[model samples]
Target: HACVIQLPFNQKVRNNPDFFLRVIAENASCCYSMLKAKNPGFTLGNRGASGMFPSEAAEWLCYHAFTVKLSNHKVVYKCLLKPLKFCHWGCFKTGALAVLCHMVTVLANL
Candidate 1:
């Protein structure tokens, strides 16, 4: 089973980051419960930009630990630095590079 959650713009830009994390965790838990009831052996996979982030990663880890009882699940963590084709836009290149650099720094520290 797969699902894409579209959070509201206001919620995404909320002052309290924990609020958005809580929303994601609550929704993910509900989905996991439903899917687990239907099939005990089902594997849960997370994709897209959110999958690579720390908050979502924590939520997925917790879900896997409590529900699936397994720590190994495939998560696609794509680099966000791809160029846009239609408009020839390189606008977000700097931001994407920054995020990639920051991720490398964090990983190196760990």
Candidate 2:
């Protein structure tokens, strides 16, 4: 399942300034888990058209995106390693290649 959150350009977010960032920070793990369950190999892509927002809002969104990506990587890394502890070097190589492929896909999408 894909989830999309649309925040209206409203006075509350404008007044609080960091509200959007705070929300993302607090929910990053939840979002990551939800998406990961939907697709274990989930990769984060760029925020297209995010530049259209005001600089402050756009910057905050970028920061939030960074945090979410970091959180997602942490979860994915842990999951990837869990079953590899008993595996041989070849499995490690395969896991590394998978991670590289995921990174390349993300970059390509950007």
| Among all candidates shown, the one with the greatest lDDT | 2
User: Which residue pairs of candidate 1 clash?
Assistant: none
lDDT tens digits by residue: candidate 1, 25-65? 57655664565466656443333223233233333434333
Clashes of 1: 0
lDDT for each residue of candidate 2 in 1-110, tens digit (9 for 90 to 100): 01112345533323442444455444544553454467645343323312222222223333334544444545423332322232223323334334435556887999
Please report how far candidate 2 places residue 8 from its true position, in Å.
Answer: 10
Q: For every model shown, what is its TM-score relative to the native structure?
A: 0.27, 0.27
Model 2 clashes, total count: 0
Q: lDDT scores for all predictions? A: 0.36, 0.38
